[model samples]
Target: MKIAITSVGQDLESKIDARFGRAKWFIVIDTETNQHQVISNEHNLNISQGAGIQTAENISRHNVEAVITGNCGPKAFTTLNSAGIKVYSAVDGTVAEVLEKFKNGKLKQAGGANVEGHWA
Candidate 1:
């Protein structure tokens, strides 16, 4: 499966960014082949508003199956859910660490947005 992990930098070694919308980068990885790519979220990182919705739209375009992040807001969560993308919340540690947890089925799946909009 292809999963996107919110990251502080471009690589798996980078720390996971807690905020979904304002994350610096997203590390998209394929679990089977172990291939990966980094997508930057520079535009949404400091937007005056609507960052979560915009960022969620951008991520959905990548066709990622799931998202790993510390927090997700209402608009973003609703948007992602509409696209059939699963959101995993309260995730921490490096991109690699979370990937491992996901692979092991240890990460928690979020039922709904855990934070309010414009949270970050």
Candidate 2:
């Protein structure tokens, strides 16, 4: 499975960014191969609005199966859900740690957006 983890930087050691829409980067890891790629989210950081929605669309286009972040807003949650992508929120620690948690099925899947829009 390909899982995206919001990050403060572009590597596994980077701390997990709590905000989904405004996260600096997303470290997408392929569980089977252990290969990783970074998706920059700079474009959405300064948007007047719709950052979460736009970010969700970007993630969906990358064929991500799931997203792990500290928080997700309503619009992004809806968009991701519609695209059959699972969202896991309230995540913490480095990208690598969280990946391990996910691999071990220790992370909980979020049922809905944990915060309202513009939460970042």
Candidate 3:
């Protein structure tokens, strides 16, 4: 499965970003093939306001199966859901660590949506 882990930098060694849609880069990791690519998030701040559509489209383009992040706002939650991508919250630690948790089925699914203006 293709899992996207939000990271602070361009590599998996970077610490995990607290927000999903606003992360600096979405580290796309392919579990089966062990392939990984980092997708730059050009609008970490603005995406929260009006780029949900674009973020959803970008994620769809990657054929991502699920997203692992520390937080996801309500708008993004709905947007990602509509795009047929599952989102799991509370994924802390580095990008690689989070990916391992997800692969081992240990990452917790977000119990609720985050409030707007919570990330900043």
Best-matching candidate per TM-score: 2
List candidate 2 stretches off by more than 4 Å: none
How would you encode candidate 3's per-residue C-alpha lDDT over 1-120 as one tens digit per residue? 898887889988899988666677888999998799989887644743555446666777899988887877777787788778888976679887887777788877764565563433
Q: lDDT: which candidate is best?
A: 2
Q: At residue 20, give the lDDT of candidate 2.
A: 94
Off by over 4 Å in 1: none
Q: Model 1 TM-score?
A: 0.96
Residue 3's lDDT in candidate 2 = 90
- Please report the TM-score between candidate 3 and the true structure: 0.85
TM-scores for the candidates: 0.96, 0.96, 0.85
Q: Model 2, range 5-101, lDDT digits (tens) per residue?
A: 9999988999999999889899999999999999999999999888889999999988989999999999999999999999999999999999999
Displacement of residue 13 (Cα, Å) in model 3 is: 0.9
- Candidate ranking under lDDT, highest first, comes to 2, 1, 3
Colliding pairs, model 3: none
The models' CA-based lDDT, in order, is: 0.91, 0.93, 0.77
Model 2 lDDT on a 0 to 1 scale: 0.93
